[model samples]
Target: MVDRTNADHDVLLTKEAEEQTKNNGLKKKMYKIAFVVQRYGLEINGGAEFLCRDVAEHLSKYCDIDVITTCAIDYVTWKNEYEAGETRINGVSVKRFPVDFPRETKRFDKCSEKVLCKTHSIDEEMEWMKLQGPYSTKLFKFIEDSKDQYDFFFFFTYLYCTTFFGLPLVADKAILVPAAHDEPPIYLSIFNDIFHKPKAIMYNTKEEKDFVIQKFRNGDIPHDVAGSGVSLSEKMESNNSHSLTRKESFITYMGRIDESKGCGELFDFFQRYKKENHSPIKLIMLGKTVMKIPTHQDIKYLGFVSEEEKYNTLQNCDVLIMPSKYESLSIVLLEAWLCKKPVLVNGQCEVLKGQCIRSNAGLWYENYEEFSECLNLLLADEHLRDQLGNEGRKFVDKHYSWETIERKYLDLIERV
Candidate 1:
């Protein structure tokens, strides 16, 4: 029985100290853990990048944390640190590595900037980038260099970051928090048919947990199911609504606007709804727009709002319209619940189905017609939305916060 309360704050503890702490009432000493994020840091600003930053910071309160990542440069001028050498970031140590880039062309940086900034597709330009990009070779070398330093390793997304870096690092313990199982091939390539299977053992959500268990027979790979959580108290405080007009409000969608995320379906359905009924509710999408289609006028796209703006939008919206074709579990859904907002999720998602059934947080629709119908139903009734929203908040309070999720990781560390 390793004690979990007295986690080490600094200075890596010896094996004897660890044993003594475990034997005593103190929590196990904080292990020196390293995180591999290819991005700059918490301020890098994508959903996965932001989540990684937060999780690393929160975990650091209970463990000795460091981030081994790439440098924030146009080309590959990375070293063993951020500015020059190792630097501390909000109590977490950061070390950067140089990636392998090809023979210089000044045009490469401009093209890279265009692609990343979303100003130009640069899809064609990447052929040159492929020759020049240092991400792959540098990543492998960085992993090989730092394998012996950390006790545990974590990655925000698997296929892109972890599978490449973590696969080589033979750490005593490895954890991955895959936001959603994006595609079958990506995971299949990593862990074969049973990619997420080992992790199901550690997570609590039976829907995701058991589905993974049932999928794979390989019993050797050790993994644990992990989910991210937020402090609901802040959310609860913002749940009350002053704009509670019985008038049907606009349907809102918040997240990235890529096609795979069901953006096309959402737009088509919303357009059809507008054509059929003079619905008071308009469909609103709050995120970066990847497409250039001009048909979605009523479907307003507020590109990349700040945290305050996002919460404000969630608070004001009557119902959230989600059309994800596939999702492991969506953090956006949890955010909606925390705002006391009802969600309309696609029924195809196993995780969303379970969340809807378990919490009554919202409804699920299979097709565009059904999706339109469900939105209409919510529009027609305020009480239903209220009931669902309240229930959803209660469910979130009970299950989906960082406080609860962190304990699972702590337990796994102790047991492993």
Candidate 2:
């Protein structure tokens, strides 16, 4: 069994103690955090990007935070005068630098390719370094040029882009949040082990925490597990559209339109069910499609909605179906819960399965039949849907809110 008592108390006390320290001025230091990621605000379409945006927004309130990334243009155009330099968004600063791509031995343009398990490796990481090294060099130069201007440096993602770039510059004072390590060629484990400096490491789930601890820490990971949950209530009142009615007859999936996300599977299931039963239930997909895939008849693709539209979609949907083959505890799932919508998750996500079972917020299924049965059950039973959604909302309120989770983040920062 896991040691829950000591761990839990340490978490609570650490959070409290940090607040106490800040109040006492024992830890009253304003931080300047340089968040180094591969892509900046324009390319924040995925889970990591979503989390990075949240962290940037929240941390900016406390620190002098600037996001350092590359211009999504090729070497020739990216080298243009207008593309190079720092710009401010809200209260945060962004430095976009020129990125050079290696010879096209493969199909990736490097200008607009998604980083995947296939893309993060010793060979690929070195290539990533070759491509992104100039940008990182400029980032480092920007930091070094303004040495006393910032106090902290935080990097997003583990094996590739940010880890190599941000770790060396900040050294011991750096923070690394390894989002999820599930997608792999197995060799990434070695890079993650060796390259991960003992500066504070943050994870999104207990599963990820344990995985890091087991592999890197010899069953003793000195890290804090943070829920990738966000602070939405502040914006909720202003952005709230309408309360969803029980009469709504639809299911939705939100995320990338990629094969690994199980979009094809969802479409196939919906097609079979629609043909067999003539169910009037609609299936809507939200988010941009990176690859060309076959479309479904009744599936409505609402590609890349705004934040307001995203919440609106979630608010109206009866059920959220997450069919990703590999997920590191989705922000979309948490958002679905926060919106009081029930989720139908793939059974492969053990962390999500634990969350569903423990909170009674949703259900899990292994195959098409089970998925179909769950969908049918949710469609037929209004009472069960309400109960599940209510449970999910409660769980999110207690555990996943930024007010609660931010304290833990602050405590970790104080420790370093």
Task: Evaluate model 2: give its TM-score.
Answer: 0.80
**lDDT tens digits, residue span 1-416, model 1:** 21234434364556864564455334744577777765555434445556667677666656788776665433233222335246777667877665544335566565545544444433543343353333555555666676665666665554343344454454344565545443442333334422433232344355655655455543345546556675543533344322322233677888777687788887787788888998767666777666653456566666766666677678778898778866666777888888899999988877777878989889999998888788888889999999999998998888876666666667776666
Give the per-residue lDDT digits (tens) of candidate 2, residues 1-416.
11223331121224654575566344333555677765666435566656776777665545456787666422222332337677876556888765543324243345214233344545665554444433445655665565455555677776444456556656666677766655542244335553356467777888777766766653443468786655454444424543222244678888888777788777788888887775889887778775564566667776776676677777778899998767666788788888888999988777677678877999988898898888899988989988999998898888887655566677778777
Best by TM-score: 2
lDDT of each: 0.63, 0.66
**Which residue runs of candidate 1 sit more than 4 Å off their true CA positions?**
1-28, 43-47, 72-91, 98-134, 179-182, 187-190, 193-205, 219-224, 232-248, 293-295
Cα RMSD of all models vs. native, in order, equals 7.8, 8.0
TM-score of 1: 0.75
Q: What TM-score would every model get versus the actual structure?
A: 0.75, 0.80
lDDT of 1: 0.63
| Candidate number of the best lDDT | 2
